[model samples]
Target: MGNLKSVALLLLFTFFVLHLPFVESDWFINYHIHVTNDLPLLNSPPNQPNLFLHCKSKKKDLGERPMVKGQDYTWDTKVNFWRTTLFFCRASWVGRKTIRFDAFVADRDEMTCRHYHNSCMWSVREKGIYFSKNNATWGNMYPW
Candidate 1:
């Protein structure tokens, strides 16, 4: 009886030790991409001027999402195209038009890591790089 009890305890300990790895494996690193901009609709060739881009991410973890945050923002410009320049969050104030966008990511414990920083940029065409025209107020046009 004593021998059997010891064997059972050993097996349980082994099983628990193995389970620890699976739990710790949750420690993973991922990234997110977001874009925002507003371009006044110029009455010309493209009536409803909209921007689009064929984006590819170097990191498999980072993908594309509409607008991470969609409550407090507006579209000042009519035509715009944005892509992932880096991972940005809605915490830092870059300029007037460009505000920080928050990204909600999870870690090992499922704790939310919100508001990474301005890590994204506009596509080469959108020109979200200048940081000059980024002084417009947020209108109703968010994450389009």
Candidate 2:
């Protein structure tokens, strides 16, 4: 009986060790986020309408970045262990009112991003901000 108990314990330990990587990999996925300026180009030389963005989470602050028409900014991050990870961005331009929107909320984006291989794409246009999982189909998420 003692020998049988030891063997069972050893087998359980081995099983757990072998499966640890798979478990961690599933829980610690890194998601990619893309932000693009899709606004029409302004012909003005010195007063070009440039998009300014500041993105942040509770633990990280991505500093303000300036983007011209057709420019893109991207970053990769992991969801927190508690599954409450959230990222929000503030957008501004030459004449429009500054707007704030949530870029990534774990509960909202986890399944959608997983379906697209962990990618979330956002486009900033004159009308509003758009979101897409595959970049082929976009939905208006926030209006400007």
Would you estimate the TM-scores of all the predictions? Answer: 0.25, 0.78
Q: Give candidate 1 regions above 4 Å deviation.
A: 1-27, 44-49, 58-144
Residue 33, model 2: Cα distance from true site in angstroms? 0.4
Q: What is the C-alpha lDDT profile of model 2 across 1-144, one tens digit per residue?
A: 999999999998997797775456646789999999887766534445478999999889998998878778898887775679899999996566689999999878977987788999999988889999988999999998
Candidate 2, superposed: residue stretches over 4 Å from native: 1-26, 46-49
Residue range 1-144, candidate 1, lDDT tens digits: 999999999998997687654344322323223343234323323333233222232333333222321212221111111222222333221122333332322221122211233122232112232221123322232232
Sequence-dependent TM-score of model 2: 0.78
Please report, in order, the local distance difference test score of every candidate based on alpha carbons.
0.30, 0.84
Clashing pairs in 2: none
In candidate 1, how many clashes are counted? Answer: 19
Poorest stretch of ten by lDDT in candidate 2: 40-49
